[model samples]
Target: MKLPETAKNRLEDALKQLNLRPTQQREHVFAVLLSERDHPTADEVYVRAKKSMPSISLATVYNCLEILVSCKLVKQVNFDREPTRYCPNLAEHAHFHCNDSHRVYDVDLPQDLLNSLKSVLPKGYEASKVELSFHGTRVDTTPSK
Candidate 1:
């Protein structure tokens, strides 16, 4: 998938600021992630990216993902006993895990909810950012195991 001009600019800026060398593999990997809302796993990304980079190894995919995460370009989500999922959205938002489908979806938190949590917290417990993930069985009769 082609990245938007603004998004591509932001990524290039990030790479330059971090003094990290950019490559075709890295650009394709990041673009594949940023173009989707589904929080894909490393293997999932590898499968998709392999179409373009036929020789790309799983290790290479993993290493590229780590680099992206370390640079704060991707956010990692750890769900119930599962491999880590990667998301490209950097904004402050919560996640909802659908137990039935084992899928993760973005959830918007209310301002009052955030304020209430902040107010009730003890002093010196500063909140710079918030990440809330709820894990539970969906309303479906037969939940996924």
Candidate 2:
């Protein structure tokens, strides 16, 4: 998949800032993540990347993911005992994992709520980042006999 020139330029700039060399594999991996808003695991990324890059390997996918995460171009979402998922959304938000489908969804958190959450921290404790995830089943509204 071809990435927009603007996005490609931005990602290239980010990699340069991180003193990392931008490669086609890395670009392809990021494109795959951005292609689908859904958070995907490294294995999933490998599968998608293979469509564009038939020679791509799982190790390459993992390396690309690590580089992206280190450069702050991607975020890794982890659920208890589940495969780590990668998200390209840079916006401040949390994640909701459906217990049934095993899918992850982004949940926006208000700034006020985030501030209130920080207030619970003890004195002199500062948090540079916050990661919140909720696991539950989607409620079914259908009437049952």
Candidate 3:
């Protein structure tokens, strides 16, 4: 999948700023992530990237992901007993994990609510970041016969 020109340019600039050399593998991985907004694991990324880069290896995909994360171009989401998922959304948001589908969705929190949540911290305590996730099954609306 081709990346939007703006996103490609931005990513290129970011790599230059970080003193990292830009490569096709990195571009392909980033494109895959952007194309599929759904959070994907390293393996999933590797599979998708292989379609464009037939010789791409799993290790290379992992390396590309690590570089993207280090460059602040992507965020890694973690859940208990589950493989780490990669997200390109850099905004401050939470995640909701569906119990049945095991799918994750981004949840937007009000700015005031985010601030209020930080207000509960003890004195002299500071949080560099917050990761809040909700886990529940989606309500089924199908009629039962």
Candidate 4:
């Protein structure tokens, strides 16, 4: 998949800021994540990336993901030991996992609200990150069209 010039520049700038060189494989993988906002597992990412780069190996995808995570360009999400998923969103937010549909949705909260969670932490203990998730079945509340 060809990334737009601005997207490419963003990726390049992020990598360069991290002292890492941007490569084709990394760009492609990142593009896949960008194309789909849903949190997808590595295998899912490999399948999507293969559509454009058939030669992309699963191992390579894993490596690229690792680098991206290390560079803080992407985030790795884990749901109770389930396959690790990749999330491109960098903002402070939570993930809601639908129990019935098995879909993960990004839920955003005000910065103040998220910061309030840190108050629960024990004194002298600083939280590096705050992770919140909700798991429930979605009910059909709307009339059928």
TM-score of each: 0.84, 0.93, 0.94, 0.93
Q: What would the per-residue lDDT of candidate 2 be over residues 58-129, giving only the tens digit for each residue? A: 999999999999888899999987899999999899999999998999999999999998999999999998
Largest TM-score belongs to which candidate? 3
Candidate 3, 82-134: lDDT as tens digits: 99999999999999999899889999988998999999999999989988999
Overlapping backbone residue pairs in candidate 4 total: 0
lDDT of 2 at 117: 88
The model with the greater TM-score, 1 or 4, is 4
lDDT by residue (58-138, candidate 4, tens digit) is 999999999889878799888998999999899978889998888899999898888788888989998887889888878
How many backbone clashes does every candidate have?
0, 0, 0, 0
In terms of lDDT, which candidate is stronger, 1 or 4?
A: 4
* Candidate 2 lDDT for residue 79: 92
Preferred candidate (lDDT higher): 2 or 4: 2
Q: Which pairs of residues have clashing backbones in candidate 4? A: none
Residue 31, candidate 3: alpha-carbon lDDT = 94
Alpha-carbon runs more than 4 Å astray in model 1: 137-145
- Candidate maximizing lDDT: 3
Model 3 regions lying over 4 Å from their true place: 141-145
Supply candidate 1's per-residue lDDT for 112.
88
What Cα-based lDDT does every candidate model obtain? 0.84, 0.92, 0.93, 0.90
Alpha carbon lDDT at 139, candidate 2 = 92
Error (Å) of candidate 3 at residue 108 is 0.5
Off by over 4 Å in 4: none
